[model samples]
Target: MEVKKVDFRNKIRHQRIMKNTSAEFTYSFPVIRGIQAGREYYTTMCPLKLVPRLFKFVEDDLPPDLRAQRTLNKQRIPALARYIIDNKESYAFSSLTVSIDGEVHFEPTDSDPIKSKLGVLSIPMESRFLINDGQHRRAAIEEALQECPELADETISVVFFVDAGLNRSQQMFADLNRYAVRTTRSLGILYDHRDPLAQLARTLADTVPVFAGMTEKEKTTISNRSRKLFTLSSIYQATKQLLRKGKNDKISNQEKKLAFEFWKEISNNIPDWNLCKQKKVAAYELRSDYVHAHGIALSALAIAGSALIATYPASWKKNLKAIKALDWSRHNKTIWEGRALIAGRLSKAKTNVTLTSNLLKQTLSIPLDPSEEEIEMHYAAGKK
Candidate 1:
């Protein structure tokens, strides 16, 4: 036989363990694997006196009756009874999970301490409160426990987690929301100015000749048409949306150029500027038939583009080429010259026209009084 001397402190520790032999031990340490240079080991430990006693013990006293569970309280109170009946199993009772300081703690009650001191709970159990799965089963459990306050402090199955640099909780939240059904309409207006789609629209706007080379006069002309520029912008936005495909089906630079070309044709040819004033009825007919009916009132950009392609079934390329070849400046120049010539005739008819050749040689500041020739000559110049 061998004999050994033991310290008094060690003796006291052994006495305490022996005194509470039936008391369950739940380890309060993280179950983690560690490598030390060449060897790997798994470690776990239980902290003594961690969970306080005096927490109440609770039990159903009798196993639940699966038959009495179906006993009804319907008829007189219909809706409430149906809800209870439909969700009976969930209302019966279920467990909850909670954490304190990143470590899971359950009240020290009658339940046996978990034998396996790691990972998640697989066995069915009950807890006082739930932590994460808020709306699913927790509401029912809370309702049941409200009538049975004696189970308030009852210890339940708990799984603990470490607080040090862990991301499992955040990842779990993301995964849950990721698979949730959602509506795209709720995303609001499609073109956020900061988004890539807006950049594409701006690029197309820059490439369209009517927009790119817009003079104040030309802008005024389009502005006078009420919804001209608006129609063009709508068409561009809609086309992009209709053509968009999968995440990988990105709009190429060339495709953006093509969209620009299509827009130029829509803007230039829609009104048929050459015959607009002469054939006013014809011009309005074309506008109503093509521009107003087909081009106006597009709320979404992608839809407008789709509408254009649908309306012009044959040779969109040919229409674009015709619009490109049409000349706007020559008719404008003719109008300008005709207006000047008319003004000259009207003034000349009012008074005789003449010019003194020497008047051109005089300095502007001379202030010389003019004879009939000078007055006639100034009038003959006719406000150039």
Candidate 2:
């Protein structure tokens, strides 16, 4: 038998337009496999290097009026790409959903039932493929491939569905994400060890007398009957502020020790915290009666601590005693009303945080900055 050379280019070339639409159009895609649910879908392995070339974020190039998918979140792509590059060994991504704009022909290579069922899924060169889900992953893969070309060989699974046109694609997008649930920030902090702040928060939750067994590890909110006074996320944010640490800042041994000491000293100075720990005061009572037990107050304390440590590093421990003298009761409307509370409702706004921290700093004899002095003047005048 004589072998004939196959012109692969000719086989894959776009077909000429026909005036009468009687011609059967088909695109043959070499797919790893295909699955059938309500509609036939093909699964293929796409190289990371080819991801950018093969998939297009059409939403970026298209005018707003013509766009089908939401605009690309450029800010998110860099972080995801960094994660991919940093954790190349362990990073895993779910399959990306794509829709091809033309009919697909799957050619089976073997007599196996599964192989025969899914044949080689083909996509014509002219057919447009839109990503319904995982556009972010596609963008990240492309960005990661630029820095780590060796990752080019790594394959990501792509699920291909024949395009049912714009309306179906839009429906597919909604259907794909209809059941998605985002992980809560507090749970992320509780479970994540990669973030220094999260790790520090977990450690503080376990080690600090005030936080020990009194930290809500999984949820952001404490239940009415819950003995936990603070949330893990709140502790994370407060400690991050106390240490003057940015989201990406590295924690040194000195910083860790300082944080440990700061929280311990704070726990000692805040009588309610000690009372709650000893069961003399119920966590619920403290939460209900004092601003100090809430996240807003903790964060305010952190701000004050930062100022105190910067201004009076040598005597900061002694100065912490001033916090014990201040009336931290929620009923102190003259002090907390416009600061931590507005109409007796707790506020977490920047202005409120500054006002509360300013009052604490003043109690510690830490001279107010000019801005703080102006705010204090405004507050005093308002009171008058």
Candidate 3:
């Protein structure tokens, strides 16, 4: 049954709703009627309404006329389509940047689990393309947006800073990231250096491109390692902590400078650093020695050797030549170009002990005979 037109201006003589809440009713009114000529009143035609009970059967309740059905169908489709179309823009913009609110909007893709979430909180507040964080997230967002324009409206949340600040960058990064179940490149950008722990990381990053050039993916790799704290971060922290603990000890300025210089000399001389340069030792072996021998022992050895070389260049000339040759093997244009394909694996695994030590021993091994007692003493004294 069609809904008959109702006149808005009709005045009812009386109106009342049923006292029982369960009772439903519709009001009836008169349709407009013609007026009579020569002062005569006219009565309106009867109007009728169907109560709720009349809507029980579908076929009977609906209008019998096909024209009415067609009009309703036309109106419904366009309304539904418009709602869907308008949402497309908002979803598309989510790809633009990680926003300040820490809510990330990621584009939907087949590979991602349906509930994957993105964004960072308490991160730096910069709007620039991330130099150090969220590589995979960025890549996924960029790729998705490129493929689906509708997803460009998505946004990612992040805290960002332009430069490393007051040595707090790395620590701050760690603090914000300690609970992050998933790792991202943004962690690399947060390396700050105030505390001794962070200072070591800063120093290492300064010395090595692997740390400095770290993408978001590398941060994940670094985080999973047990030796992470003992690395650059550990060394720097230990030095800082020792200094702070001794602040009242009336240490001389010259002594302090020499102490730090000594510390750096030891850090740079670690077997792993040598591995990065593809020296006589391999990375893993160096790591093993570092673990077993203690940092202080190796540090003292490095300091002693460096001091000896500085004072008696003639005596250490062969050692200097060996150092130069190793450095040359690492970056020499002629050697790199000629052997890149053959040595690419070795070069990338620059710190691999088995690979690097074997290569070095085969190529340029030198013999050194230190007494076992001296080695033992160094080991005993060097536990840091």
Candidate 4:
């Protein structure tokens, strides 16, 4: 055994053995030991800088059957990296789980019951580490470090488990992901404070008289019998289009005020929406008959509303009032068949959104741009 002082710069991952022995040398971590299904496991904090040096990505080029983790989606790395870089102060990361295949040593601090649970874990340099989960996060961290090297000192928690062979590692990967459930988009909008559009949507749902108590805050889609009429994600997308903003564009105070005033005007003009808000009509009745109750129509209306503001900034509201004259019933399939409905089902496909927006723009007396005109030409040709 080699004798060396504890170093924080070692490029090593960890594992543990249950032998009653002392750790004399090699990569070490002050860890808390725990048990799972009658087996030993250790948890430790790892510095951001050493993370890239150790825990090398299991090459995706390796066959799926031979590897313990999925191939990393390289496209996702940029967005995740941007999230970390943009929200350095408030970002939260969960612990990473890894399996180690080598002998390890554990040294308890002292004799007390609580101290017995705490110890330093040591593993050799020749050991291999396999990620059971969080490969995306690891890749994101490496990418973030390239732009902001000062984050090297920050630490992330990692959970280490011991098992031999690729078979055990593969099983660990499967078990970690077996029960995971993704968060709903509406819930994401509800809890997200980092997204300006999400904040705008949540505030509209809470403060807008017509929307309060009439919006679904948990699910992206509203059920047939649900008392709610609109969804939070729909509000986010509609408001985004209403302001003519891209997915990640920054919004100013002026733009936010415009969004608020526009929605308020829309609320005052739509009798069907207001009727549902007042409980004068069942949600199902309005939803079944109206185009305005669905995301497709809301997005399309916002798209046209954007053009209306640009075309006649002084008279957009007067032009918007013309929507009350235009038929909004699902039964008006003659006009909406190819635009909003495909085979009697509402469709939110890209072409459908543009087509529906074209009709609304014409109703508002706003001219379509060149691209929209091209789409209109294509749709008109398909009619024959």
- Model 3's alpha-carbon lDDT is 0.32
Model 1 Cα displacement at 379 (Å)? 67
- The CA lDDT of each predicted structure is 0.33, 0.82, 0.32, 0.85
Candidate 2, residues 1-384, lDDT tens digits: the string is: 222233233322223223455443434445656456677777867667667887888777777546557788999999999999988888989998998887666678788986676455656566788999989999999889889999987888888888887888888887888898888778999878677878898999999878899889988888877888889989899999899887757899888888889999998888888888888888888888999988988888888998899998899998888888889989988778988899998898878888999988888888888998898888888877
Model number with the top TM-score: 4
Query: Per-residue lDDT tens digits of candidate 1, residues 1-384?
Result: 222222222211111112233432223223333343343223332121211221111222434331111122223234333333444444232222222222333222233445333322111112221132222233332333444444343323323322222144344334545686643321211233334444555555456554442212122123334433333334343554545532224577766665666556555554453334333444334333332222221222233333334545465545333433322222233322222124322111211211211121121111223563466456446545
Clashing pairs in 4: none
Q: What are the models' TM-scores?
A: 0.25, 0.86, 0.23, 0.92
RMSD of each: 26.6, 4.4, 26.9, 3.4
Residue 289 of model 4 has an lDDT of 85
Which pairs clash (backbone N, Cα, C closer than 3 Å) in model 1? 237-301, 238-301, 238-302
Ranking by lDDT: 4, 2, 1, 3
Per-residue lDDT of model 4, residues 1-384, tens digit only: 334464455433344323356553357788899989888999998988877877778668899989888999999999989988988987778988988888977889988989988988877777788788888999899999999998898888999998668888888888989998888889998998877788888988888788899999999888889989999989889988899776667889888877877887888778888989888998889888888889998899899999888888888888789888888888998888888998778899999999999999988888899999999998889788
Model 2 CA lDDT for position 43: 80
| Residue-wise C-alpha lDDT for candidate 3, range 98-136, written one tens digit per residue | 112122112222344532222111111122222223333
Worst 10 residues of 4 by lDDT: 10-19
